[model samples]
Target: MANYFRDYADLCFEAFGDRVKHWITFSDPRAHAQAWHSYNSTWRGKQRGLVGISLNCDWGEPMDISSPKDIEAAERYLQFCLGWFANPIYAGDYPQVMKDRIGKKSAEQGLDMSRLPVFSLQEKSYIKGTSDFLGLGHFTTRYITERNYPSRQGPSYHNDRDLVELVDPNWPDLGSTWPQSVPWGFRRLLHFAQTQYGNPPIYVTENGASQKLHCTQLCDEWRIQYLKGYINEMLKEPLLSHMQMVTEIVVPTVCTLCILISAVLLMLLLQSQS
Candidate 1:
């Protein structure tokens, strides 16, 4: 299957790799890994392009920050959603929280092995570092809390997380109830990716909302606000990134010089008075 996909990819690269600098290699990591291998091994020497996978994930904010259950559930939510695909490609396996939880559930259900896929050491090495860049798609946030389902509910991906998702009543609804206009969520998801993926170069694959309700006169104030808020949040990351090293070098040196100068000034002032 992978080699078949690679043949198609090689054809595409042969035809258009000169013009296209970035390639997604279609959906799913298996195909992506195959494409990555093909590009790096065969074409990358001459073509010179990047291969990556696009991931769409919403921020999972905890309903109650003080509650441990809620916090754990929120983290679990992210691990299940983004980490489901991104983990193997980036970190070489599923999230530990996911493996532990799903494995436990599968054991309770009388399964011999885990429902979640396992990557052998060699497979992990191959899958890891497949992405040249991380393509991200983010929009909204969901408030999460822990919720235990009955063990008899049977094996399912949806039930494995054991969390309930909620949204603030005040957030603006964009047709469906699932994705509300929660601009701050974009920032949170970006930071999570930055931390989780070791600061990979990120290109936001998809964002903004569709005007599903009305488009009579080509007016979309909601979309305008959404773009402004979300783009603003995404742009806010540079202040906290590589700048930290510069700040660490500059701040303490300036503070120490200021303290010494202040002490010298006070001593001179007292001598002048005497």
Candidate 2:
């Protein structure tokens, strides 16, 4: 799979390297790393382009911040989500919690080895430091608490994590399908990425809220509020403002997958619609 992406990337670079200054691929961590290696070794000397990977994860806030078990469950949630990929790119292996938990579960399943794939020492070195910049897509937050899911329940992703996710009943309910609007999660997630990955150059590729379709369709004051809330939390992050990075927020075509152009632009959008 990695080889296929590398070859395809080489073809694209050879064909349009002059025009494409930035490239982002949606692939597994290892495949993404291999694609970077190909870029560096084969064409980076002349291609004049940067390659990055897009990783999307929501912040997992502890249900009770004071409880050690809840805090641990929150961290475990991230390890299973963002750390599932980011750990390899930054730390050169899966999260330690992942290895231990999965290993223990595998043992219970009577498997000789962990269900999670193991990276050899050599493979680890190859994948480390592969990303030029981190493209993170985050929206909303979940309240997490510890759950000791029985290994006898059988092997599964959710069961492996051993945690339950709950949303504050008081938070805004976009709908049964949409994530609840909890802006504070944005700040915590950014801080986690900064501390965990030595603050890689982060691009907020996707961040926004959803709105129900209505007849007027012009005045989505609520969506504006959601954007303002998330963007407010985003600016509060010291690392984000520390760098001269572009903070663009584009509204998603699908509403579920969207972002911000800026508050000014959003106001203009609202004005135009009105």
Candidate 3:
């Protein structure tokens, strides 16, 4: 499977390297280590353009900021989400908490080795320093708490983290079921990526709100607010000046298309640092 992807990437580079300066080998590589390992180490050198992956995650804030367990759980949630992919690109392996927890659970299940994949020393060397940039996709934030599930519940990915997710009631709901206007989370996620991944050039591949499908509202005030709030947070962060933002406005109503375009243009103008 790894070789198959390597071959495909090689074909793409051979065909389009002259025109495409930025090349992303994968989007969210954590779900499949094999693909990341193959692209990062094997196929990366064959291409002339910059190579990286896009990772999407919501910010995890500790439910009780003063509690050590809650803090650790919050960090653990990030490790499980972002670090699971970013760590290997930056640090060459999985986060320590993931290894320890997964190893222990695998042992309890009477397995000889961890269900979490292991990378050999050579593979680690290959994977590390492979990314030229980090692509990020962020939306909303969640309040997290320490919650341990019984082993009897079986060994799924969610339960292994030993944590629970919550949302603050005070956050403004912009029509989406999950996404709330939590700009702080966006800032935190950027800081974590820079600190964790050695300040790699970041591209925000996705971030936005979802409105009702049938609602033909021309004036998307909620989405405009969402963009302004999130982008303003990014502008305030010293570490996030050169990042790119990718967003889509769902304009089901054709008459309101001009309004959506104007809103996006306004957002871009406000986002401009100069």
The most accurate candidate by TM-score is 1
TM-score per model over all chains: 0.88, 0.82, 0.79
lDDT of 1 by residue, 175-200 (tens): 65456899888998998999888999
**lDDT score, candidate 1, position 238:** 70
Candidate 1, residue 88: lDDT: 88
What lDDT tens digits, residue by residue, belong to model 2 across residues 1-274?
7788788878888888888878777734547877788888887888767888888999999999899999999999999999999889899999999999999989988999999999999999998898888888987889999985544566998888999998788998664357778888988898899879988988888887665555255667777888899998888997554442433333333343434446668899899999
Each prediction's Cα lDDT score? 0.87, 0.83, 0.80
Model 1, runs deviating above 4 Å: 148-152, 175-178, 214-217, 246-248, 251-274
Winner on TM-score between 1 and 3 is: 1
Error of 2 at 114 (Å): 0.7
Clashes of each: 0, 4, 0
- Of 1 and 2, which scores higher on lDDT? 1
- Alpha-carbon shift of residue 255 in model 2 (angstroms): 52
| Candidate achieving the largest lDDT | 1
lDDT of 3 by residue, 23-81 (tens): 77666463334444454555456654577778889999999999999999999999999
Residue 20 alpha-carbon offset, candidate 1, angstroms: 0.7
